[model samples]
Structures are given as structure tokens and as C-alpha cells.
Target: MNSDEIKTGEERPTRNKWNLILGILFLAYGSYRLYQKLQIPDDDNFGMILAVGFIFFGIYDLWKYYKGV
Candidate 1:
């Protein structure tokens, strides 16, 4: 194969559809859970903390996709 036949890095890469879908799903679910958790009066509940973690993870995933990283 000739060198010219190889693809160059000049072309823009396509993002995965699944990544976008999962990111949105995670973000939405986490937000919803967080809202629910906040309504509870229990201070010992760790649900909110876990929910926030999910939200951050989702945000990071979305950011990676958006930045083409």
C-alpha cells in the first residue's frame, strides 16, 4: 500500500452516538435522584453524595465527547 492511501489526521473524527446518549441519561437520572434526596430530612443519608458523583461523571463524559478528546 502506498503512503498516500493511509488516512491522515487532518480529517475530523466522529463521536460515538452511545456516549452522547449515556451522558445525558446519567446526568438526568443523577439530577432527579439528587432532587429527591434533598427533600428528605435525614442528614445521614449518603444518597445525595452518590447522586452528585454520578452528575459529575456524566458531565465529564459529555465534556470529553464535546471536546473530541
Candidate 2:
């Protein structure tokens, strides 16, 4: 394809709405995991860590959306 066509076909990251939806989903999943961890009788250190990581990633996505980066 020509350069102009290629440039036109390329999507700007900030224009993608799925990023925001995915971020919200990640946040929700993290919260759900945390709740599950709390309900478990045994120690859930791994679950807690994973939940924290998910939450952080979600927040970072949100930040990126806001910053348009």
C-alpha cells in the first residue's frame, strides 16, 4: 500500500475505546479476586499479590487514558 494509505490505516492508541473498557474490567476482576481471597479459609498470598498487580495495571491503564499516552 502507499504511504498515505498505510498512515491512514494505522490506529492511534489513544483513539481505541477498548483500552478504557479493559481497564475497568481489570479493576473489577481485581476486586472480585480480593473478595474471593478474603473468603478463603487458607492463606491466599499468591491471590492477594495477583490481585494487587491487576489493580495496579488497571490504574496504569486509566492513567494512560487520561494522559493520552
Candidate 3:
């Protein structure tokens, strides 16, 4: 394709709707899980680790959306 035919900027599609939705869901769930863990006396390392992972993944997905990736 010719350079003149190439698309750029606004011509490109924005982030997928589903991606944003999933990211938001993940963030909310992870935050809630973390809070619940903190409220209880039980100290489960695995739960905390998973919660942190989900939170980070959600953050990453949101960041990707902003970065237009």
C-alpha cells in the first residue's frame, strides 16, 4: 500500500468496548476481594496474591486503552 493510503490517528479504531468492560469488571472484583481479605482474620497468601494479580492486570488493560494499544 502507498504511504498516502495509510491510515493514522483518528482514522484508526479506538479500544474495543469489551476490553474496557472486562477491565473495569476485573478492577472492581479484585478491589472487593482485597477488601474482604483485609476484613477477615484469616491470612491467605494465595488469595492476596491472586487479588493483586487481577488488580495489576486490570490496571495494565486500562493503561493499554489509554496508550491506544
Highest-TM-score candidate: 3
Measured against the true structure, the TM-scores of the candidates, in listed sequence, are 0.75, 0.71, 0.77
Candidate 3 local Cα displacement, residue 15, angstroms: 1.4
lDDT of 2: 0.80
> Can you give the lDDT of residue 15 in candidate 2?
41
Taking the tens digit of each residue's C-alpha lDDT, what string does model 3 give over 1-69?
A: 999888676565487666687788889989999999999988799999899888988888777776667
Clash pairs detected, candidate 1: none
Instruction: Report clashes for each candidate as comma-separated counts.
Output: 0, 0, 0
Model 1 compared with the native: what TM-score?
A: 0.75
Query: Over the full model, what C-alpha lDDT does candidate 3 score relative to the true structure?
Result: 0.83
The TM-score-based order of candidates, best leading, equals: 3, 1, 2
Cα deviation in Å at residue 14, candidate 3?
A: 3.0
Off by over 4 Å in 2: 1-15
> What is the number of residue pairs that collide in model 2?
0
Tell me the RMSD of model 1 versus the true structure. 2.9
Candidate 3 local lDDT, residue 69: 79
lDDT of 1 by residue, 14-55 (tens): 777666787898899999999988888878457888999889
Which residue pairs come into collision in candidate 3?
none
- Model 3 worst lDDT window (10 residues): 9-18
Give the per-residue lDDT of model 2 (tens digit) for 1-69: 777666646465664566687789999999889888888886869889999889888887777776677
